[model samples]
Target: MPRHRQSLQLTRLKKAGIRSAAMLTLLTGVSGGLYLADNKADQEAASAEALFAEQELTEASVNGWSQHNVLERKVKAEQEAAIAAAAAAEEARKKAASTTSRKSRPGVTVKIPASCNEYSGNRAIGCALLLEAGFTLSDMANCLEPLWTKESGWNHTSSNGGSGAYGIPQALPGSKMAAYGDDWKTNPATQVKWGLSYIKSRYGTPCNAWATFQSKGWY
Candidate 1:
């Protein structure tokens, strides 16, 4: 951490009424305005989450349907790790590097179909394999799986709530799907392929943007 970063962290510690290396690093990487205010919001949301998570747990569901709370818990641990990395290196290499968004450890974990025109379930299987390979991030299921649940409900044919964002990651304008494949709506593999690429290019990992969402409620 640079002197400025250290100073900022201390200041945030005072204002947010919490002290954790993870929160500090995440706050600093926000790349937005309303620093103290945003972090305060993040803290408020976290507190709310802690209060309601147990009640929110759905043991009644089967087949591991939407284990969002599980996913979120894992993400917090990873975020802490990222912050600790920043902290240990504070004096070793002074200064913030202009908020380089965290990169998706690219790899996927789905089985590849022999051809593109496979069954829809087969496409999903391929996507799972792709995630295991192209975006093989450690402990990232929580960060990504929840948002995917909220976005597309795991439906390959899913479309936007409004703005016409479409498919797995809900790419806005829907036409962005063209960048991946022609039959984006029907092919889960193609949608996931594009989704991972979009996250890597724009938000880094799902965690980076999730941290942003934690702060300001959107990315």
Candidate 2:
């Protein structure tokens, strides 16, 4: 081998080494730039995804609040309705009690005279007849006494010109008592007997008849 040829070959080899180093540096720089751009793109995409997720979360929270508010309103309405219904029922009960009080009459206490014979003519006859009609002396004092006193004062011949009601029980037209006797117009005993029968059939008792009379002014 010649010395010059060997020196030329070494120079050529050094030049090739420098070219390879330059090429490696250029490739490394390009790869680094591509990596940085890809990283930036990935960061932007992650930021966008985070923003979308945050927006969805905010919307869900708003919807949840809206549903909760609706539920709260429904519960409040139901509670108010229940309170109103209870108040109405109480008012109705009070009104019913007041009406019942108005419809019923209070009881009265009365004192009886000692004997049927202690009364006057017609009064004594009425007292004796009342006792014979399966009624107590208390019934006469509390019911029959006041009842006949208000009707016809125990007079068999007593007549109402306006209504044609007559006799001790004030039978309308006075002929209704003929079922007991033809002498119902004049005989006090017959009128009393017919009156007692009518009271028993219609009202069951003299006290019941008196209560009806008190309530409606008629029996």
Highest-lDDT candidate: 2
lDDT score for residue 27 of model 1: 72
Estimate candidate 1's RMSD in Å.
Answer: 46.7
- The Cα error of candidate 1 at residue 210, in Å, is 2.5
After superposition, the stretches of candidate 1 with alpha carbons farther than 4 Å from their true spots are 1-134, 137-139, 216-219
Q: How many backbone clashes does candidate 2 have?
A: 0
lDDT of 2 at 18: 96
**Global local distance difference test of model 2:** 0.83
On residues 1-219, what C-alpha lDDT tens digit does candidate 1 reach at each position?
689999999898787765555687777767455776788899999999986875566543532555766787889999999899888798445434422211222222345445423334533453354455455433145566556666677677787666788776777877676656666667676677777677778788777755765677544
TM-score of each predicted structure versus truth: 0.40, 0.46
State the lDDT of candidate 2 residue by residue for 45-72, as single tens digits. Answer: 9999999999999999999999999999
Cα-lDDT of candidate 1? 0.63
